[model samples]
Target: MTRSPIITVSRGRFSSTATQVLEQVRTARLASRDEIAAATGLSIATVGRTAALLVERGLLRERPDLARPGVTGRPGVPVEIDADGYLVIGVHIGRRIATVALGDLTGRVLASTTVRRPLGADPDLVQLSREAATLLGSCPGRVPLAAGLVAPWREIDLLPREREAELHDLTGLPARTGDHISAVAAAEFLHRRQGRSEAGGLTLYLYARDTFGWSVAVDRGVQTDVTRAASLTHFPTGADVPCSCGRTGCLAAAVDVLPDAARARILGATAGSVRDMLSPDQVVLVGQAFTGDPALRDVIVEAYAASTALADPVPVSFTRFGSDIQAISACTVALGPVLDDPLACVELTGVAAACRRPVA
Candidate 1:
């Protein structure tokens, strides 16, 4: 909302040596400089310097307590994300409800609450901002760095720069907005990086609920440049349901086309068709359409399996976060700046003072 340089990192345009080191430590949860160097192809000296910078900025912590007992050097000391040092606010404006959450550096949700939205009403920035502030206030000692707002693309017109500015004005924090689908894809990307580096390939993320869309992540980054998810709402699903477009079988219209089993089959078949067209290396299913009912989920899975064209099955999985994906995705966007450039974020957000306060 403030158009700060730090907030623009959500656009997927920035990365640095510090980001590389921080990301390695985050992925491993704990890694020595040498381990980071090995994983990132950076020199040990570079890793040490970068790790030191990150530690000084409060994005990482030196874990001498976890050092190898018999070893006695910097390489013996591991560093991990300093999860307690700061917080970010995540606001997800959905069709019927808005969720506000406080998240730690490690993408853990600290606190969250939902505010219901009246049918067909525009989101109330003032109300959502108050909710976000309340969440942040609940965490006594935590310093909030930024806020991220996400909504359906159709809703994007309603949340122009003015809306973002309103949220920033109300909450006293820099705020940025992003497409909900892409944010969810980024969250999934971060989740995959937890224990190991993601294998190199294209990943297709399919989402459904009050809206329908898909997003793509190429290796480590979500494809933010592509913003055509809203167009998928009109994809033909071959069902005889009426659409606002004066056509039948549109994906959005097919959602309520018939019996639960038929709906599941149509959704699954639609997903498979998209997957085949993209030929992605993997597929991840998310949103209430996929998670709300077990029977529907099973039917969709069967239909998807039958629709694939490849001899070798592409790996398909459901989001582990389930209904919590919305909040987590928004948090991931808010955390983007820090993850992209830790030292810059500290300076930009004036978080340096908070970093100096001793941790309890």
Candidate 2:
């Protein structure tokens, strides 16, 4: 039961009105034209027109069976996400595991599989790509339109350009890659699905897997370009540990050797530093380190106290996921196109506007 990430683009190449309507329908899961109009504050006529256009774009589908009986000339048919029409392929390659899953337009997982790997070792791309192929081939309904590749920000630097180009060739679908933690943070900000509070201003997102990393989310999106000035990984942990980079001491190395309390304190210090420099409105904790262990939760709570002690305090909470959060984020990337928020596409608002015009 991997939970899908909720995604919302502020402005898409598609009709913002159409995007709004589709977002409403997705949020509601199912809705009639009247309901869409009410939710989006658009005219009923506008809803009908936008929805029809969305259907034409394959982002929506009409459900006549959901229409109520005893309606006048024609009851407005309820529409739901056409989950069966398009599929997203999500790939998350981590030090511990490599995963692949398929999702629909609404980001619902249809099927998934994973393979374990050596911790902190480079992934077997052939094996990972093979698994991804198998998953796509086995999906019962819907056609996969795109693929999303997710890994630690550091992994991006390690992958070769030739290997990167081959991914598109391997999948035969458009593909996207991004920082794993940032993807989750973006999803948290957009959908607020994990029961987290509304995101605004600077948000501190921290996580630990086989490695540790953090990102900043501002105004409902993760800022993927934080430098050493804003990164938590650069904080001094006051411990001399041998780092894999051949450095004498680094925060990443020290954390593994330190106790939970010490690690929390370091995290708190990092949070406090981030607050002083960035002034985030909230703190979001993700990854297995935060939620997988109750003791870590206590450590984080304690760390939160220490971090905010000297700076402006903000709300802090761990994101709870019903399924593998990373896999879902990866899937969200592929689902972006069908959801009308692809990472890249041409704007066609003028075309959409023309479609709304009545034929002579």
Candidate 3:
């Protein structure tokens, strides 16, 4: 049993003990005070006090039947996330489309809307901010704790720091920004209510859409910082095609000549390069190419085989999320500060990999 450590919660916030206790309850789905104490290494009395505080905050609920008498013969009730009282908003900014969604405290998407906008081309931060605010306003859910915006790192980095404040002002809620790939990874890790993702150990994420890109994670956390200019758009693909970057035979340019299946294979091969560089335990392919097209999915598997021609090839899988992955993930990233404890939760899960922590 891993002993949960009491971590310092920031000032003017929930106490360290209460935060850790609530996290244990959320992670376990439901837990009695004794279970939380056992998992977190806090005293039963401490867990009881903290649980009381969490319950008062509407963050947790007590299960009367699960209650058992403690050493003093007082009933100890099990608690779980309230799930109905809190919400998060996520915005996914893509080259061809943008989306805004509302999610519950359990990370379930409750309402969402899609708008056609070329975010990758000429990004109008002001317009996009207004659109996101409007979309969020139209949705029905609990008031969101915060809103998260996700775009390609290249595109997001172009926005000045003041852009976050502008977004908040328009949306009337705190707002945060992150790379699309990292947002996808966070959604995969934090919102796995149905089943666990096959992504474990060092994992590689292959993304295909308006641009060719990828990101890496170990254990559920992104391996790179949001400020890192990571991209695979220009990697050579040995083709004679002209690229938008004025280069011939580039990966992004190969789309004109290669079939979807071939493109999937090339993506798999590119994933292999990451595997060689980091030796990940698994590779996950996300986006429309893998999930929407069956032929392309099979082709990507073949590509994975060809790419890992060497000994000890890593396994590969695909995300079950549909088109809304980016939007839902952005919400998770926005809620990351609360869901994913920087030092305590990471240390408990044993993933300690680094990325930009959420502000809210």
Model 3 spans with C-alpha error above 4 angstroms: 1-15, 65-76, 119-141, 192-200, 220-229, 340-360
Give a tens-digit lDDT track for model 1, residues 51-139. Answer: 88777777888888998778788876899988887889999988888899889988988989999888688888888887877776789
Residue 253 displacement in candidate 1 (angstroms):
1.7
TM-score of 3: 0.77
lDDT of each: 0.77, 0.62, 0.61
Tell me the TM-score of each prediction against the true structure: 0.89, 0.74, 0.77
Deviation in angstroms for 266 in model 1?
A: 1.2
Backbone collision count in every prediction?
1, 2, 0
lDDT-better candidate, 1 vs 2: 1
Which candidate wins on TM-score?
1
Q: In model 3, how large is the Cα lDDT of residue 71?
A: 32
lDDT of 3 by residue, 13-116 (tens): 23367666765665577778887787667899987876775565556777675665543233256778777655666777777787777776667787777778
lDDT of 3 at 178: 69
